[model samples]
Target: MQEPIQNRKIIHVDMDAFYASVEQMDNPELRGKPVAVGGGENRGVVSAASYEARKFGVRSAISGYLAKKNCPDLIFVRPRFERYREISAKIHKIFYDYTDLVEPLSLDEAYLDVTVNKKGNPSATLIAQEIRKRIFDEVGLTASAGISMNKFVAKVASDFNKPNGQKTVNPDEIIDFLEVLPIRKFYGVGKVTTDKMYHLGIFTGKDLKEKSLEFLVKHFGKSGAFYYNVVRGIHNSAVKSERIAKSVGAEHTFDENLTSEVFMMERLESIAATLERRLKKHKIAGKTVTLKIKYSDFTVQTRSKTLIYFIADKSLILDTAKELLYQEKMKDSVRLLGLSLGNLNTEVKKTIVVQLKFDF
Candidate 1:
């Protein structure tokens, strides 16, 4: 008897060293050479490194000075965000043609839920291959893809293959694939978390599965629940398009939480500045401003106000946040302060042409 295939189908598409690859694609002379995208001076950091540069230990977020030391002849170029964004939109449109269930992780990577696709294709592997081919042919760039029953496996499978490659993980092969996987390869397991896992003799997914939930939680706090689910290849998060903005804000947990109001207000001002910049960048306006306070004991509370009109002004946001902060009846000393801009109007503008098309 033949086993029925599951209806769930997912695809993970990721560009290869996106910024550096885009530059190399535009300039034929840069191909097969060490190239980096970022400022080249003393203080600048490397944003992306070519595969050639990767051989010399150069990587993104590493200081430009260190990157040059790693690869002496590495060519550095400034990022072209506008150009990248234009290309990203085109890539997203291509995914929409296949399926509207697209979740973009960044400008370079996205996840597609193709269980019910426009083409009614049963094979996800073939869909991935076709998408990759279209990207290469139309966009003049290469991409790697992974096809699987779920997002986690699909993401892992995509990385298994290198630049310009595709891979698929069948349901039958899940256990075999996870048995030999390193603990560090798991998502959300950073260096600090990985070190703690190693100390507890958790070197692989199989080892992690052996630990009790209580034990994992004792060490990893809230994230331990996530680790428990991921090890068993279980995740329930859906591919949602209309993702509501849960507290549009900026916050930073200090290396050492301070109690001084002067320094706290200074931090709040910086956060407000950043939020205002992001608002302008996204061309978004909001009607509510919220102030969040987290005390040393981890207890948190928020104070918010609904304003008369949409606002994106820097000074107005900071002043409103400061007023909200003053109104908070504090029961304990503060550890973290955050500012959020909410009630955003993100509705798409309906053009006359678009309306005519809709009428037709």
Candidate 2:
């Protein structure tokens, strides 16, 4: 018989400073130094930063210019996605030795369900420890894990202990743990949502729990129901082995912000070609094309159009992006441009599986 959803065992494993760590591991000279991957002093963006660099507030998504400004000794290295994927596959193999229900969120993190694992381990905590050890032994990379009853709480706990550590939020402690958690630390609560929650006087999970579902729904729409359930330890999302891609996209941040439409159109051509290559690599096609415009002032605007048929060609993608670009007037000088294809040819049909949850 299947166990109740509440008794499920979930583990969230996250690699620390994955790209930068990989670079450091391969090149001994980079060890113990402030290293950043995929950026430089003059331009580009930092894709990842070593823990050493993070001490100085260097992080991903920030401009390389700012990263250097933060840590002058930070070393910049190019990204090697293929090597990362190879290491990721090896780490995943270690996960499968314990359980088949591995849901990878990215190349650096994944969620594993080990309630009824292949190793027949009864304690999820021990299983997480063994898995981390095996990953380090086999892949030469350190990973952190969070063990709990569900994916949401597990993912949050994984961040509690960083750089080769683990945290287990037992079933009984779930409520108290979440109640004390800052509202900003809750997964899915980004800057905009946090600001909205603060405006409503919701600073912690306890404050959020006090709000009625109707009040949250009135302010947050459908997400209010989500918050209502998760705060009460009611997230039942299962770990699926396969996840479908919703869109294929590519974006570029210019070295200099362009004010002219002609310059912007020229940039869009390259971005569309890059998007096309990604679509073809994944064999993905979509009927909807979206153009993302990021202004020099950091404001973002998007324009989208849908077609009767799907397309993956660069010409078609560029034409649609060009149309969307000219469809709107310039709000400010454009710093970044992005193009994405959605309404994909692929389908997403989720199958929920209730697991075997026996008392330990």
Candidate 3:
């Protein structure tokens, strides 16, 4: 028989509007104002938005045109990735002071397993508090945290309090907390899923919990079981400290859709150059090159080619991408072009390690 899961101390730390915040921190004139990173009035999408900008319905992934329409005063700034990485390194250093078992979600968010922390702190709540305080004091940035028994709940709870706040879902409160949670609040639920759930009258965790595993599977297919288990607080995923990149890629969306195959080849060449730079940065190569195409109508298509030996040169990548692009007839005018390298040479051999403890 399998053993039941024992309580584990998990903390999810997320920086508030990390990109926009970094811009504001470096430029005092941008502080307390609506700001956006990596967007323009005519082209591109908003990568991140300040809290002030969000008030006017401005958010990431929206078009720059829409962002500006929502918040006319929104100040758009170019993204400085090197500076963000510098601050990220400093913040990660702080995490190591508490625990070595940290799983980074992105440049601004991470999960820390503090059950066996360097600080010898048994209370994950207090540890989260201290970590947030340290980030603000040392890095001059605000962070939010969520403390729970597993990564799922902790990740969800972290968003309960925004900017610089922390929320702890105690063992005893986990049931009630999940039951009352809005279905849309579930970390994995997207806009489409939320709408599907709403149509089924599954507005909250309590409503979802009432459905049978079979019923969920019937409606949601493979994800039905996930909904059933998570509603009951049964997530068992561990925080993987060493996450690997499966592929390296770079893409660009053009302001004007190109109908000419010649134009697409020109765009592909530049994308290949960007991909080569990324591959060399990681000192990794791949045998498979995939081409991603987004049409003017918003449909996407991909073509891939694999080689016997790993390659990372722009010449080779561009050559393969060109072959794939011509391999088929495009359905419509192309709006975006991207290239990716996969089947990486950095693939690690998996070795199973026996678990001595299953507790968090």
Candidate 4:
């Protein structure tokens, strides 16, 4: 059976062609014309392309040479990241005006938990409209908004109406909305995963929902549960407020106790590699390594060492973890081992800005 919808209100706001729009706004001559940020005389890639340029198949991450071929008159402008950040900060201020439960996905996109907003407005849809209006009026940038009961649906709905538009997925319509959603449109379903889904006869959310949890887990590993829940319109992940991350780490429990140091080293290596990827994805480096060891007897021991400099490389993590591992003497059979990197960079999260309310 499906769960009842939580009374949370989420709004995902995405600036339409943020960089390209900023360029057009700053220069009157570029308005309503095909424009892109990044890719000038030098051999570079396009970071952001305007809707006009997109019509000619111009897109971000494509070579400048190819972009020109796609649209002969496509204008390339180098990115001014500092300027973008300045404007992004101004836009963020607007978000803060409404609620503190604002989770910025990027400079151009954010998820707002307006459940307990400062304005005391119970309608997340109205809050979204006001935010979009303020973005256009104060920041001179058009944004698209999506409103729903949770982050996943809200984010997906945001894209349905692009370029200064908004869409709301009411609680009663969420199931219907998700049923028709393409697998590719779901969060974290990249091209590879989508192709895998296609191979498994999961073309849409409905197809995905029909699969057993065991089948999904067998096919997609850890993320299988994520897919299963999301297909049912049941994602419960909350927006997080800004905070400094204390560590980067991953750990796993063994089906059986392991006695061999060699086997334990192998597991640490795998754990270290996973941690490195997480650090890189978050663009963070840490200065401390901690090795957690759990014995079959229910005893847990941790060994940690602070490094001279921040490191996020697999080799560094593995080496540090290995040192921490070998430095300590083993006492009993091992049931679990975890590796963590401490002293990390800044991170952000939060939820329920309007305290997750709606109009009666």
Q: Whole-model Cα lDDT per candidate?
A: 0.80, 0.90, 0.88, 0.87
TM-score of predicted model 1?
A: 0.74
Query: Against the hidden reference, what TM-scores do the models get?
Result: 0.74, 0.94, 0.88, 0.72
Pairs of residues at least 3 apart in sequence or in different chains that clash in candidate 2: none
Which residue runs of candidate 1 sit more than 4 Å off their true CA positions?
Answer: 1-6, 245-274, 280-313, 316-360
> Of models 1 and 4, which has the larger lDDT?
4
Off by over 4 Å in 2: 1-4, 352-354
* Clashes (N, CA, C under 3 Å) per candidate: 0, 0, 0, 15
At residue 166, candidate 2 shows an lDDT of 92
Q: What is the lDDT of residue 146 in candidate 1?
A: 84
lDDT of each residue in 79-172, candidate 4, tens digit only: 9999999999999999999988778888899998888888988888999999999999999999999999988999999999897899999877
lDDT tens per residue, model 1, 2-119: 2223346788999888889888988899999999898687656688999899999999977688899989999998999998898888888899999877888889999888777788
Tell me the deviation in Å of residue 336 in model 4: 37
Q: After superposition, how far is residue 341 of candidate 1 from its true place, in Å?
A: 5.6
lDDT of 3: 0.88
**Which candidate, 1 or 4, has the higher TM-score?**
1
Name the top TM-score candidate.
2
